[model samples]
Target: MKAKSESLTAKQTIFYLLLSILLNSSGNGLTVSLNMGSALWTASSVNLSHLLNFDLKPLLVIYGVIVVITNTLLLGRIEPRRIINNFLFMVPFGYLVGWTSQLFNLLPLNQLSTPLKMLLDCFGILMVSAACSIYQRVNILLHPNDDFMQIIRFKFFHGNSTVAMWVSFVPPIIVSIICIIISRQIYAINVGTAFSLLFQGSLIGLADKIIFPSLKHHGVEQAVN
Candidate 1:
């Protein structure tokens, strides 16, 4: 019975993981197409691409590598399986974000008024937050950034999601500032970015309670094993 329960939980986790990825990718697509602003890490990537004259895709991988390193440090030990899972997550997530971005570009969101665009931007962030809650609870494969946030939330902040998110944002904020100093212009800092900074963590916490309340956070030890 115990083995059967564990097997069922594993299947459920995979289902939720894929669903969360789709939601996250769609949210990213909406934010990118609306063009008001992007999530802070994404904005930082854009800024770095412009300032360093590197292609966006390669720069993103470099950023992911850095985050992976940071997560390893936070963990206080190298967990090779967890590290590999984080990178593996990027493979499908990257392609999905690209395809979804193209799909959202076909929408009439851009033609909407400024107020409406801002509203949609916030909605996009909400979707991302909801996705975060689901996958973090699932706690299997994770994007490097999400893994960093999860480590902070559970390990450092005593499971305070909002505080962990704010702490996790520091690196991207510093990168954005550096790019501003060098380039003298912003790449993707606007209303949506502001929304994410202010409410994303809170929304994720909220989503955890309301989105799938039965799906308790899995044991970290069990997840990696």
Candidate 2:
């Protein structure tokens, strides 16, 4: 029974992880549809994709590799199984994002007024933040990008997750700026990018206080136990 419980917990954890990935990808799709910038890392990836003439999927895979390597170096160990699982999960995540992007593109979002577009951008940020909160609360295998942030928080920032999350945006923001300068176009760093940088950390904290607490009471903890 103890072994069975652990197995069930593991399965539940994977389910939450997948759901979080889906939500994150959907939020990303919405961000793309709004013609607004995405979170820093994704925005950087988009710029890199355009600059390199490579498809977003392949670039994401390469970026994931770099994230995994960085995370391993920071943690001083390689959890091969977890890293492989993350990559496997990312395969479907990529497809989901593609499908979601197509669906959002078919919508009338592009025709909405500027104010409405800003509202939609806020909604997208909420979705991404909530997904991140769920992923962190599950406390299972983390995506490499998120894992890197968490490691930095714990190792360097005195476990200040919020500060760490914001700081993680800096490098990507610099890259996005460079891309914009070189191309003479504001490709992916826009108002939405600024909004995400300013507010996403607080939103994630709010989710932790409100959303994650409710989830814990509603069988999530049972699964973990």
Candidate 3:
């Protein structure tokens, strides 16, 4: 449906993918360093990481693998190419998470006041939302979590993406609650997590509205000329 030149080259695709990974990881770093929670999936992953005394990178990998496996089971076949590409994307993404976590640790956010920390949490959420929006626009290989959500939306939700997305949060929310009960502490499920869960969808949609139309307009102008 689109021209080949409109498609990203391998190098460009890799660049966008890495940039998305960096932005996402940076946001995760900010949230962790500020002792704030992130999105539902991130909160669940953080809880598991803390509970098991494992680093975030390994937990992220395991989560990605689980999502991929779930997707394969649901779809009734393994798409080897897609799976390999997703795995390749995950490796660098996991590394960036660790790298950025360390980078944020060097910051003095720990000394900041409660209000300032909360503000930073919101900023971090924005970064993550923007990163996801960019990645979606790139139209390259998707992260397993995103792919799984899409599959669920199409297969089970009658293609109602909005409802499917909301339903997808249920599992992560349940996991976070169980982790809290087991740990006897609210590890990372804080006000930031609530904010992200409530507002991220709207933010992403807003980003799409802004990004897609501008690209379309540019394409139209070029064609007319």
Candidate 3 minimal-lDDT segment of 10 residues: 216-225
Candidate 2 least-lDDT 10 residues:
216-225
Clash numbers, per candidate: 0, 0, 0
lDDT of 1: 0.81
Please report the candidate that would top lDDT against the real structure: 1
- Per-candidate Cα lDDT values, in order, are 0.81, 0.71, 0.70
- What lDDT is reached at residue 86 by model 2? 60
Clashing pairs in 3: none
lDDT (C-alpha) at residue 50 in model 2: 77
Residue 20 of candidate 3: its Cα lDDT? Answer: 69
Which TM-score value belongs to model 3? 0.83
**What lDDT score is found at residue 80 in candidate 3?**
88
How well does model 2 score by local distance difference test? Answer: 0.71
RMSD of candidate 2 to the truth, in angstroms, is 5.1
Candidate 2 per-residue C-alpha lDDT over 41-124 given as tens digits, one digit per residue, 9 for 90 to 100 = 778877877777787766777777788787777667776776886687556665666577779999998899988887787788
Candidate 3 lDDT, 1-225, residue by residue in tens: 122236556786677667767777788778876777777788888887887789888788888898888878877787787688678767677667667877888988789988888988888888777676666556455677766665665467654445656776787888888887888766667878988887776665566566543321112112111
TM-score of each: 0.90, 0.85, 0.83
Residue 162 shift from truth in candidate 2, angstroms: 1.9
